[model samples]
Target: MPVENSRIKGLYKQTVQERLKLVAKAAGLTDEHVQALSNHGELDDVAADRMIENVIGTMSLPVGVATNFVIDGKHYLVPFCLEESSVVAAASNMAKRCLGHGGFTTNNDEPVMIGQIQLLDVEDFEQATTNILQAKHELITFCNDVPSRMIALGGGCKDLEVRRLNTHMGSMLVVHLLVDCRDAMGANAVNTMAERVASRLEALTGG
Candidate 1:
């Protein structure tokens, strides 16, 4: 069921279960999605043990929904899980104010990010930087050497750079890998590429 209006008054007065049902109906969440949102959101003792290290337990937090959002002409009830109070109220209030102006819209931007490879104990920063620049094409190719859906979709290691950063420890050579991550957060892709190219970068710089 689609919601006719994003604005919903007195939502905070409802109980947690009541609010969950309301939001579930409004968003047309599947039964599985609704069940996942229940029981601390698929994050019980077993899940906690599998997810991270030294799992003691999972702490419960208040899950609040911020209503009155219309992005790209589609109504959405954004949910927030945090300890902070009044934040959800503030967001819902802001959405009501913007609802008169056709609500919020979206404009997609290229989601490119930079991943760094740190090289330490570089004796010749100038020479090392020069070597990296000369082999820029080769390094980029090496990063994208593995077959990937991201690379096939024209999003992968696209550019490279070498610079010197003076830290409290010493002046270290840093290699930046510019990657277009498409519609995803580039953490996994960027980090994997950086790790894959680390040995080569060290060899090139002799650091």
Candidate 2:
């Protein structure tokens, strides 16, 4: 009779094959893992290129997780993936030095982004800018019309600025919209809003 080991917590008994399968599944590995497994036996000219994408080939980088970090007395293991030589070793040494003198502390600035709308071929530049400024309430309302949950967390458009400059293509005004993006990389959102605003500005300025 075979025994089944299914402990719910902490430690459980599993065969080597069972553990490997569990790890492979948990890691969300693709067919690449299968090929790597197949390549355990070295062969001359083993061409296994059917299992990956953009396979000019894959590159390897050394990854390290540093321990002994305490934030408000809570321990953390911060992992870093880097390919630079000796970076991992240097980080390990620095972390060791900081552990005894209280763990490292860090704070981040709120990720805010700026969107620019260039208004060219204006009828009356000053009046156009004034019109935009007078309609600030409406403009801000329109700018905050983002459809993402991250952007909708009261972090859409904050303010708008107008910059007048002279160029070879005549005098142009660049409208700058500052946006606060809570946790997302907001480049796409910023650019999209900028383009929309540019179109609206062109309509207003007869461009």
Candidate 3:
């Protein structure tokens, strides 16, 4: 569903709790979500340690609001967390200056990424390259066959490319898998696909 207008005047003047309530109501957020945001000390030592390596204490940064942003015909009050002064003010000033020209427009392509697999110690580079090219469809299908929620969401391997590289050690072959990850970052998905196809690639290249 499309978002309604975000032009909430005097939002920055309100207290933290009042601003949270207003934002929750405007965004159709549940009471539980609002309560979570309102609560302090939410991230204790245990939670902080679990989130990253080493059991160090948590750090804090000042979060300020930058107002008067109209992006794509929708107004916004962007929250910025930083230690430097005048950053938020500068951004708000720039955004207000651009409002007369339909604000900022953004364009993004499909979220596709490349996964590379390197093959070394090949006996015959020419024949191995030919074999991999011949089995391109099978390799792509193999990558898509893995149990991934991304594939169910209309995202998976899209194309394959092979390149031959000459290193100081010897000749090496690299296979590139082009995958569309939809809304995900796709690091895990791409790495898993590369790992799954490694053995088959070894057999084909006699690596």
Candidate 4:
């Protein structure tokens, strides 16, 4: 569900509970989501420790509503959760100013990211490039061999490319792994794949 009108006048003048209610209504938030947002620092010490190392504790930031935004003919009341002051008010004011100019428009391309595997100390650039290209299918298959949920959902390594970059240090081979991460950010998957396939790439390119 979309927000009907983002131009909520005097939204900052309201209390925290009032603003939360308004955000819940405009953003079509569920009861569980609303409860989680209302409850600050829901992440316990154990949970925070599991997330990262040296986890002293968890912290909470104030979430403010940046009102008056219309993008692609849709009204939106964006929420900003950070320590920086004046960001929410500034964004809200700017978004309101763009209301008369048809708001903001967008033309986004397909979501796809690349993982580069740099091969240093190569003997022959041409031979390495040829070798990698010839084994592109096998390399892609190897990268996708993992039992990843993303791969199961038809999102994984789609193609492979080999480039010979002539840096100031020397000429090295760079293998570009074309991966379709789908809905996820693809960092975890891409990083894992890169680390896993480094040995194989080295054997292929004699790096």
After superposition on all CA atoms, what RMSD does each candidate show versus the true structure? 8.4, 10.5, 7.6, 8.0
* Residue clash pairs of candidate 3: none
Q: After the best TM-score superposition of candidate 2, give how far the Cα of residue 51 lies from its true spot, in angstroms.
A: 26
**lDDT leaderboard ranking:** 1, 4, 3, 2
Which digits, one per residue and each the tens of the lDDT, describe model 2 over residues 5-75? 11112111333234334434434446776345334233211131222111111123222333345554444
Best by lDDT: 1
Candidate 4 off by > 4 Å: 10-63, 82-85, 107-109
lDDT of each: 0.77, 0.57, 0.72, 0.77
Candidate 4 lDDT over 1-207, as tens digits, reads 369999877666555566667778778889987777656576553443333322222246555667788999999877665556677767878988999999999996655678999999999888888888898888889999999999998999998788888988998899888889989999999988888888988998899
Q: List ranges where model 1 is wrong by over 4 Å.
A: 1-67, 72-91, 100-102, 105-109
Worst 10 residues of 1 by lDDT: 49-58
Give the true-structure RMSD of model 4: 8.0
For model 1, what is the alpha-carbon lDDT of residue 122?
89
Each candidate's number of clashing pairs is 0, 0, 0, 0
Candidate 3 C-alpha lDDT tens digits along 67-111 = 557766776656564456667657767876787777777779989
Of 1 and 2, the candidate ahead on TM-score is 1
Off by over 4 Å in 3: 1-64, 81-85
